[model samples]
Target: MQDEDRRRYHDLRPDWAESYIRLERAASLIRTYEVQFVPGLLQTPDYARAVLSVVHDDPGEVERRVGLRIRRQALLDAPGGPRLWAVVDEAALRRMIGGRELGRAQLDHLVALAERPNVKVQVAPFHFDGHAAAGGPFTILRFPDRDAPDVVVLEQLSGALYLDKPSDVEQYRRVMDRLCTQVEPLDRTAAILRAIRAEL
Candidate 1:
């Protein structure tokens, strides 16, 4: 295979994609949980473009990044997407990044995603004391395959870190569980989204 082909294959490899893929796979097997922004797998393209546009200078590069995000979402529709459980901060829902229409669309998208059989959506209200996300947004992916390693993907301002170490992954898992417990349930989350849309 040519160098580019090799790279593409590597990117497409089933065992794992990157650190994120490993984490995502693990998330798929068991229950995966997210806190902060909507999980990448549930993000809408317009919301993604608006988020990416802030950091990327080149329009082409921005589009590529957006495309990558959309592709990442495919895992949600795959034969067995993980049992996706996401706790989104109220601030994230209120932030008007892509204008009212796009923001409304994103919220609508979230409502739809929450309806999926294997998916759960929760909302962490800003008024709650324990609602702050530690180290920003992070996901703890647990795999049904006991042999597969649990993974955590932490997003940062400069880049992202993928953690597979038992200790670190365990810590993130606890954090995710705590956040989920504190948030409103799926139906309430959808209601919150509706209220946000009404205001927009």
Candidate 2:
């Protein structure tokens, strides 16, 4: 979320730091295209801790962030929660972020989540032809309110760029649609996850 948008939405939900949390909570649907790691909304506690450890030197800060992330997971199971549609690059699944055991557990968690009605997970295999999103990972947040526009979030190491422009939103939506066509369908995700988990 941009600083300006943060201020605009400040009255809606009064929470400080990372206003993206408010938008995430308000979104009715979230579409994510991830090439490097699991989406935050779907990550397990161990995996979240492992990822946070690399950036934060303070163990206490890492635990705090991990706890916040885990608490956010509850939204997925809440009644009438937003739908989560994720297209993950196959390499992300193969990478052992927290070592083999943790990787396997992560995959197991993914398999379980895919069973939810509102959650859709797809794997973009290495052999995927004509990759649409060469630029890298991004997430699109959409609200149920018809008047509110779609938002595209492009993240970097330091911060994230939020775009609500109609042109930008459509362009990213097209890329996401193309990526979905290139990746395995929802039904095949389970078998793919199991195979990768076996490798771990």
Candidate 3:
């Protein structure tokens, strides 16, 4: 990958820098949760543009970030790429972070990506009561190399936390497992996405 294809954050936080390396190098699986917006990997170009526009006022920076995001997504399609599973709260789908048209496009994009053999997308609906992941969004990355322990990434306003401690990884794994059970089944996600798109 080219140097510019790497993940780029405005703040250049050290945690994000390290996290990016792990993300690109991990060889087994990538699982993520989103409570407020579409997962970065799954966001459409237009939706990404909209989302980036909010945090960055500079057009050049916004465009650069969008390109980086899109490049990261290519990892999913690469040969022997990690299996990607994402669980998103239904509220994340409903929030109009990028306005109605772009939001709808984003949902449509999600529906399309869910069809890929290596990707799984599930939605935690509003009616689903008592969730295990009340602490907001996080990601679990498992590497093919046995020496590399599984890592749980917790993103905060200041930066990100990469937790590799066995206990911490196990706890987040349980939370993710519960979230999978609480969400709509994979078979039905496309239908729900289409319905949401129509409403938007």
- Top candidate (TM-score): 3
Cα lDDT tens digits, model 1, 9-31, are: 45334333355554564465444
- TM-score for each of the candidates: 0.82, 0.90, 0.92
Off by over 4 Å in 3: 4-15
Could you tell me the lDDT of residue 107 within candidate 1?
92
lDDT of each model, Cα atoms only?
0.71, 0.85, 0.84
Task: Estimate candidate 2's alpha-carbon lDDT, on a 0 to 1 scale.
Answer: 0.85
Would you give me the overall lDDT of model 1?
0.71
Q: Write the per-residue lDDT of candidate 2 for residues 19-95, one digit (tens) a residue.
A: 56877888999999998889999999999999888787888778777877776777798777789999999888888
1 or 2, which is superior by lDDT?
A: 2
Highest lDDT, which number? 2
Candidates' RMSD to native: 4.1, 4.9, 2.2
Error of 1 at 24 (Å): 2.2
Looking at model 3, residue 101 earns an lDDT score of 84
Task: Indicate the TM-score of model 2.
Answer: 0.90
Model 3: weakest 10-residue lDDT segment is 4-13
With candidate 1 superimposed using the best TM-score fit, by how many Å does residue 2's alpha carbon deviate from the native? 16
